[model samples]
Target: MKKVLTACLLFVSSLTFAQQTVQRSAKLPNSDITETFSVLRSDKKIKQGEYTATAGNNTTLAQGTYLNGERAGIWSFYNISGKLIQTYNYTDNQLTFADSTDTKGLQYVMAGVKTDDDVTVPVKIGGSYSFRPTFLSKVLTQAINKDFGPVANATFIHTFSLNSKGEVTNHQVKVCINGQNKLYQVDDSELDHDLTRFAPAMVNNNPIPCKVITTNTVAMSNGNLPDYANSTYLGQ
Candidate 1:
């Protein structure tokens, strides 16, 4: 009997803590949010010593490391059900790693966004209700302003999709230069990450997947955009 009990104890010890969400406040004014600091033990791997953000329904919205109350390292954003929507690499509070051609990577401004079918789209839910564009923009602006600094000189265009469970997927970004919509180089990692901080989407009083796209401009002192003449073709 002792041997059997000892074996069970060892098995339990191998498992990590249960996933949990906690409410936390930012020292900076008007930045309160729910944080999932749990060290979750997934079947494939164990995620320890990282912080995750969640909405009111306990769906993971963002995941990253925090140093002295500031976001650090590669942060991942998810839809309402924890699907990876976007990833942002940061260092010393500055957004980095803005160059990629992956579907989830940044793109030079191009002009072909396909339209969705006539199905009922998911609604952006906040707390016990849906979110208005103005409020959503306000929340996104706070995170962008804090992490990526000002963006008065460039436009960030981001697109993503959510599954029927309101989980985000198929994340992408694009950049525009010179105030023209035809900008190049994708540099909207911070914008995408911040946008994931909102509540999940819902349809017919139930969570449903949907697509989201947002555009925002920042005012920096630069007027010349990066010239990637050898850039990969968009269709590639």
Candidate 2:
């Protein structure tokens, strides 16, 4: 009788321990419900239920019911001022919203459009120009010939600017002599003369003003004669 009683007691104790282990692993629904009420407290993925996230008294940050971590239903987002910035319906990582017509608006903004007042117009200042690197090199070569002796070979740089109307307003030339040396600076007036006379640049279907820059060099042969070589140009 003593041995049987001891065996029964041992069986009951083992069953109780097993039940407690299962209960510890299982989570009660009410515990999750209690945690979901606080903001910034629960970062775990939410399931299908209604929840409100508020920024302040009047400003509601976001409010909606999420289904399996995906916004199955409607989701509304507000700015700090409580203004409705965007209302989105997200399903499987896809969003549906109104089409945007800000393409021209963006361009206008980039063109330096002022927004001080409601009424504004795109200022039509003047045209502009950008020189290709190849063109710049050619200009430099030419300038070197005029300033220095006949350049056998030369490397030049041209810098020009564009106005609001995309017109070339200024041009500057820097020339490297003897194929290597400190660059010689030339005035925009000189470059303007050459560009307007020989290589005029146009902007907005009109011929706008521009400047040119160049570097020159001369190659001496055994016979003491200079050999003219081609150079490169740069574009802005």
Candidate 3:
């Protein structure tokens, strides 16, 4: 068994009751969240440590640290497809930053996002519960594999623009393999699936246009990385 000593922690908490580090996983009470956190070696109670919660498919939902059983430090919250939505700084007692900038990275990319008063993004009719299993898994995985040839494992970044009418256009995809990225402007026929539906972005009772971005990590395994389930993703 692996062990880590909370040397000063035990001295302060229980006069030498050092805590043992062990791998622990459980579902949060009254919630669909399953999480992993550190617990006392002797008492088995949650101790100060890193905390992570994930969706049923093992997609990360929230990530942060816990101090004396309370959430501490920076906490990042994400939507179902793994796009970062917001972050809070617990240690400084600040709400920190909402995802206001265009999500940019080598493996993933999205463009042209501005934070204006009350300008909100579009939403799919059934949220992620309906979106992921229905569109993402089937559309991206099956479509990409069939169209691009049987890729055993890879990462995908899909970005598309939506108008006030909720009509999504300019769909583009970037396939990351071995750190090399190939960008593809996909046609509806090439993808072999419809781009799903969206409700429409809103601003002060009126609809607005916005961009939809998502990242998916696909690894063929027993379960670690589900299709599009990321570290997780930089969705917007």
Candidate 4:
């Protein structure tokens, strides 16, 4: 019986490790051209490594790394000309801090709308809150409790707008635990308090209004990582 149990355990372990890494490509939404991009994944979750994105012209649009499904280290972004436009740091997928000394670091992720010849578009700026891996790891490993646990996969979406100065305002947030809605219609002031750390977006050497959206997902079960890959542009 002991040998049989050991064999069963090995079979499960093999299945877990057999979970293959994946790569997916798609076109960005609302783009004028067929601008395509791709991302690498492991165990269905985005892996920690270097990635390059290309535009419709096959020009490099961005290059960066993902650490445990979050952008970590430094990411370099480029324009249509392939010129380096922005380089930024991410901690736990949060652009919480920037070093002034490093001029290469981006102050904000640009959010803009295209305008037609007759119509004008508005400029907005924003950012969101994310969980640190250390904190999240605890939550994942801990037993579920009524007061302080999800014990299963969950996702939270926070949206907001920013002024030219990079301050968060006019926001809405929703939290879902294991596919169940827990909180929605949170106050803007309450959400703004946590967004004070985000850097502002800039355009043509001037700060501009930007819209920010952040999605946080926690994968609690095996092979559950792929579902979180819907949006490759996190914290942007």
Candidate 5:
């Protein structure tokens, strides 16, 4: 019985390690970069195992492991000078390190619809609130409870923002109370959940502070409140 179990374990291990995958290489279209990676033998499209992209000058642009089809494990991004710029762990969903000073990486991961890398803004780890990994809901709930009172059928314009350091800053809210426009500053600290760990926005593989501007309509959250002067509207 012991021998049978051991044989089965080894068989499974062999299947996992020596599977139907082949190493392949491809030159990027219109680019001097070549990518060496593994793909499924049956379908040449599904990437598996270790993957690397190199420039024409023999510089490693990007290297990471891909499990089946998605990016897995820790991926290290290098600057143009081949300097280690950042390491992001997809399994743990965290950024290990980021060098904000290095503006030129051997490679760059440009994302979003913006072509101007200099003005690209920072983004939260989670693309949306539902996918966010921070305690944003808790923080926002606290702010609404303190400033807006409670959740009702009313809605308010709440700008839940964070600083370049990925910390909860002075988020604001705009609401009309008693026919007067009021703006309240909700000061909250990110002692528990910080945004930096999510590998925030980087320009040319350089980690820098960026602000995410979002117009959030918090409905059924901010309730009745006292009237305030027009100047109190976040000083306009």
Candidate 6:
């Protein structure tokens, strides 16, 4: 009985050791191993064809696809340091090809343009609720007014061009009074004289030229004639 018990114990120990060794030597399947790339500030994990990157603080820095080990597809970046970015698609271990001067890039360029360039005007297109021009215009107007102040009652016409990428360029102003049906060229000072403000129109999520009109009405608490306020301009 003692010999049999000793043999049984030895067999159990050997089986345990063999199982442990097998487990240690086994290689995890590639499917079980997720591909990941990490930086000091951010870390990205890739699984199958999906990729997601997060900053140190748990902020989503980028999300896209990984082909093999290379970045592929469209990637969006926010801020210079790549604090926020997104990647899409996977092709040849790199992001898919995007036109260098796409609409989004052109919008950034147009926003920085010092000189004017003649381009096409962007027409309003129907889309989802968020893409409606009227909604955007109202939102922009309200934002401008909240930032600035109420503007005077006058018709100010601004002509601007948009490049093929839907970027605004070549901004000019034309003003018209109630009495004058014809449009008149106005200088920047005159245009700026009134509390007028402009937010560039957007086309396909890009800035473009769109006409904006601002009007303000001034009222006095005490009854006063309109002409009395303009004493200096009475003779002129």
TM-score versus the correct structure, for each prediction: 0.30, 0.23, 0.38, 0.34, 0.41, 0.19
Task: List the pairs of residues colliding in candidate 3.
Answer: 82-233, 83-234, 83-235, 216-228
Clash count for candidate 1 is 10
Q: Relative to the true structure, how large is the alpha-carbon lDDT of every model?
A: 0.41, 0.35, 0.55, 0.43, 0.51, 0.31
| Local error of candidate 6 at residue 182 (angstroms) | 9.2
Candidate 5 structure quality by residue, lDDT tens digits, 1-236: 99999999999986875587888998643244577998888778788889886766687867889887777888876644577766778788776665655321111233353665664334333222111222123444454356546433323444544444554454565654334455656443332242223344556666554433333222342353222110011211
Clashing pairs in 4: 124-209, 124-210, 124-211, 125-162, 125-209, 125-210
State model 2's lDDT: 0.35
Clashes of each: 10, 28, 4, 6, 5, 11
Report lDDT (Cα) of residue 105, candidate 5. 18
lDDT by residue for model 1 (1-236), tens: 99999998877764423233223332111123355443333322223456766554566666677543445677765554555545555453332332121223312221222354223333232211111122223334443444444344556666655565554455554555444443222222333243433323443445455566655444444332211211111321
| Model number with the top TM-score | 5
Ranking by lDDT: 3, 5, 4, 1, 2, 6
Q: How do the residues 123-211 of candidate 3 rate in per-residue lDDT, one tens digit apiece?
A: 54323422343224335445555555544466777776777766666667787765667776654432212124455667766776777
TM-score of 2: 0.23
Clashes of 5: 5
Give the number of the best model, judged by lDDT.
3
Q: In candidate 1, how many Å is residue 37 off?
A: 7.1
Q: Which residue runs does candidate 5 get wrong by more than 4 Å?
A: 1-16, 104-236
Candidate 4 local lDDT, 1-236, one digit each (tens): 99999999999985654344344555432221232222344344455455565655676765666555555676665555566545556554334333232232122234453332232112221111111111122222232234335444556565556776656655554556655565344333322232243455545555577755656555554423222222122221
lDDT of 1 at 133: 20
**Residues 1-80 of candidate 6: C-alpha lDDT, one tens digit per residue:** 99999999999986764443311111111111121332211222212234443332343333554344344565443222
Show model 1 residue runs off by greater than 4 Å.
1-152, 182-200, 221-236
